[model samples]
Target: MTAVSIEKKVNGTPVASPELGEGRDHPDEEQHTPQPTPAAPSRREEKRLDKSTDRADARLDKAQEREEARRDADHKRETKEKERQAKADRKAQQRADKDKARAKRRKERRTAWTSLQTRLTHHMPMWGLPVVLVSLAVGATGQAGAASAAGMGWASAGVPVLTEGMTLTLAGLTGQAIEQRRPYAWLMRATWITAAGAATINALGHYIEGKAGDPQEALYRAAMYGVASMLGLVLWWVVMRSKRAAISGKTADEVARWKRLGRRHPLLMRRARRVADNTGKSMADAYATVWERANGARPGEPSIREIRASRRAAYRRRLAQSWDGRRGLRKQSERAAAVVPVPQADTVGTPESAGSAGVRTPVQAPALPVALLVPGGQGGWVEHPVPVLPMATPKRVRTGSDQSATARFPQGKDAVSKRVRKSVHDDRLNTVRALVESEAARGCDLRKHPSNRAVARAAGCRPGTARELLATVLAERGITR
Candidate 1:
């Protein structure tokens, strides 16, 4: 044991000392040291850890669900897009098909039109050559026969050649003139004259032969000879006419129309030609001008559409005007009530008393009961005292003093027949007027001098009636003719 001094200080000043002992004699003393222990987790921390785990799991599940929903949406979107694309493809294919069909149809129509035009315009060589050959042979034979009968013998054959050659040359000249669009009237006349002379010669020869034999046989032979001699000329003339029409740029329809117009309106054609000569205009233009001047309308005026529209308007107006009356009549007939008139005896004045005293005594007859016919439950009409509605008055009324009720109402089948006749007359008059207007619009020179025959033929009316209607229409339109 050892002692040691211990001191205590307050502030910096030493105050007291104590003895301390050191023990070194114990050899087996144990040394002990303190160590810290870890503290356990709290319930809130464990709860928070569990909540974080749950939140992580929930977030993962939500992410998986979102991905699945997105995938589904994408799949649905792709399907919809594919369907739309397929629909578009189908539409495109259908459109292509329709276009192909339309194109094919158009091609077919064009092909048919081309074929038709070719058939119409290319017939000269097919029939013309055969006809020409036959006609030439016949003409030559006829001419030779005529010459032989005239006692020329072999010289007659040479004469036939000369005549046929001259005719052919003239015919060729006429064709050339037609092709050149030149005036071939003189050439045509020459050809006709030559052909006629040849025909006459052939007929004369036949006549001479027949005079030596049977007269009937001579007539038949002469006729045959004349017909054979003119066959070639006729064929050539037709070809040349067709060629002329082609050169004039006139279609068959136009030629036919012009021919029809000429036949129907010779006066118009003459007037048009005169106008053409005076105005120095083309015949067509001059014709139009003349037609306009005469008809008071341009060519093709009052078109079918216009006429139809006018007719429809007239019909509509008439219909509107008659609708109410017709409807009322129909309704009244459907619910008709029969009316029985009550007869009352009339008061009579004695003639002698009136002459003697200038006064008349009136006598009244017995009144009769009025009955109305009504439908019974058994579908039969029964008379009753029930009041019935009176018949409706006519739409038109006459206020003249001379017109009686009977006259105003116009009863009986005769009245109906008269009405029907008047209606028919009006319809016929309208028809005539339409025909006249249509003719005028179609370029007929109706104002100056209308063709009554043409009008009568078109209207199916008497010529006198047509003339009267024409005059009436012309007068109504302030025209002189």
Candidate 2:
């Protein structure tokens, strides 16, 4: 053990203590150093840290949610905008399609109206305009007079004239606009009659009613009507001449239209062509006449072919009737002949007619001797036993015109008939040849008209003569038939 010292200070003086020799240092001792104490966290700091962690997490969550909502809104807005745009486009397309259909119908009606007007203008009578105007004027004037007599409120002297004049003028203007330049002959006559009747009625009204309001005016109106009528006549004549010239000088389009119409109306065209051929008229004139007939004008004259066909039809009908009558008469005659008895010749009964009743009995001819006596003996000489005549012997005739036969006794008659026929044929050949030659020289096409009947008609010869002449001509031409 080691000794240790102790010291003490009391008040201000130093002092030593005896008991201070306490235990001293040991060899193995430990020393301890003083350390400061750690402090605990505050409540505010802990709360602030918790609040900051929570705020950071909450902010991240809020940002993610906002992004999701923005994406959703953008997608929804895009879908809604596409749907609205599609709806607007569909509505606009429907509106555009409806406007195109109404424009096509208006064009078709205008063309038809023009064609009708042209047709009416061409067909109506021209002279009827003035005549109808005059009659209307007279009728209106009479109506006004009647109204005046009845004490109507509309009755005025000027009213009648104004109405009459306006109506007549309108009618005249309509006639002119319609291009009426000429009337048919019958229509002209009717119009003239109507005009005369109107004039008579007007004169009678003026004279009887003691209303000769203005004679000069009446004369002037009459002159105006007369002048209009005369002018219409002149204009109609000029228009007719011009139309005739136009028809004669047909345009290409007119000619083509006519051709198309002719093809459609083939029968009418054929008739027109026939008329043109027979009457020596121009084909255009005949075609125009036929077209007019088809358009409701007077019918054209019958063609030569039509006349001939009618005549032929009538002749055939008469011939058929006569033929039927003749056939009936013949049948009647046959029946009468069958009903009546016929006389029979009486003779010896033959083997064929032995059993049948009312059959004619056939007579047997006697056989002649094969030998004949010549005039070697006198006429009064008796029949002597003559030798049998040879079959090859020829017969001789005594008369000048009698024919001689070179055949045997049995065939002599046939030979003589043939010789006589040959002589007659030879005599007819000369006259037939002359007639045929004359027909040939007259430009007859003998080959096409090689018929004997045709030759007979043309050559004024018999059919047999014509046939003989044809044979001769054919032989001359080295054309044997």
Candidate 3:
């Protein structure tokens, strides 16, 4: 059995210890023991616990408020920074757009300035207005001075308006007449007369005013006043002329050409006028028709056929007169002839044979002389002749056809052989043949071929030569028109 012992009690309750045998069924202890009830907590301790809980809650709320404020400040700062950046971008974009527009306008202005017509006529009014105003002011002053000198004291101011006004009114009428395409010669003459009279009056007035000071100064003042009074008239006349030209659809060059033509040929202009009235045609058409009839083909111009004929005649004359007014064929006969194979049917006839057969043949021209005209001892011209050596003739090849002919030429360093001549002829013929083929391909009738001028241009020869070549080619191809 364990021993039991009694222990000291707290709060008036006794405790039993097992080692002291106090917890055993103690026959020595009281059988009926009273248990002690638990006591309630004290008021002071409860109050202390409530105070500590309130302090913790208050600290948590303050920390939450501080966190919320810090977050709001950060959000505001971020928003402001974004807004600033957006504003900067917007401003930069605006500047870029403005700069682009400005550059476009500048480029447009530069392009507009590149044309000569624009340069001459654009902004003419802007420049002319200032000149007109200045001229009016100076003319008025000169007229007033002149009128006062002429014993019209207060009436002098009205005199300038009458004189200058007449000129201006006449000029306006002239402009109106020009716009209507009516005859404005009388208006122009009247305007000029009025302007001259006004200028004279202004000059006289200025001279009278300045004569009291110095005679030379008075003359200078008179000239200055006169010119100033006429300055506006001159500018107005120029404007009127420009407007007239524009309305008439005549360019400056066309006006200059007409003026030159009129100056050179007054009778022609009168004849053109009569033709215009009789034929009911425009002056230009009448002039052109009359000119073509008086001259030939184009106005004041010769036909291509005539030009080529003249050139060929001149060339032949020069060739004939090359050696002291002779045929100049002796030099050509001295050189050896090269061998050139030519078909019998294609053989060109001699001049005498051509006259009988009505076939034209090309005559061989002589060479130029190897002589230089040097200054003579007595100041007269003397010929210094140079010696020329003969060349070896090429061997001729005989064809099977008895009618076939071979032209021979010399083979040397300086000789222009018959082979070269034939080749040049062949080139010209080939050019004409190609032109014919092209025309035929384009559906043109071979009977009616192109003009001689076109063939001449294509073959790089004169019209006469081209005409002959074309005829030869046509005859070979059995085409006749």
In model 1, pairs of residues that clash are none
Under the 3 Å rule for N, CA and C atoms, how many clashes does model 1 have?
Answer: 0
Tens digit per residue, CA lDDT, model 2, 1-481 = 7666777655444545435432335434453432333455688988999999999999999999999999999999999999999999888877766555444455556667777656444433455446544545555565455446545556446645654454334433434433443333344444445444444434444443443677666666554443443343344445443453354477767757766967788887886777576545577767665554343222354433444468579766544432311234454334333332223445577445556787774644322232234455556534433222112222255464343443221223343344544543553465356655666788876565457875554333478877877788768866665
Candidates 2 and 3, the one with greater TM-score: 3
**Which residue pairs clash within candidate 2?**
none
Give candidate 1's root-mean-square deviation (CA, Å). 33.3
Among all windows of 10 consecutive residues in model 1, the one with the lowest summed lDDT is 18-27
lDDT of 3 by residue, 1-481 (tens): 7544558766566666444545557657655553665775588977988989899999999999999999999999999999999999999999999999999999888887666435334323557878987998899888988998899989988988998899877887787788788989899999999889999999988888888899999999899989998998899888887887898898999988888998998888888887677646688977875565343344545543455478578766554443332333555443324212222245567333544656665644333244557899878989764332333243355445533333222122112233344655786698688889889889987777687887876655578898899999888889766
lDDT of 1 at 244: 74
Error of 2 at 125 (Å): 15
Model 3, clash count? 17
After TM-score superposition, the amount by which residue 241's alpha carbon in candidate 2 deviates from its true location, in angstroms, is 5.2
Candidate 1 regions with alpha-carbon error over 4 angstroms: 1-127, 152-158, 260-283, 300-481
Error of 1 at 258 (Å): 2.2
lDDT of 2 at 135: 47
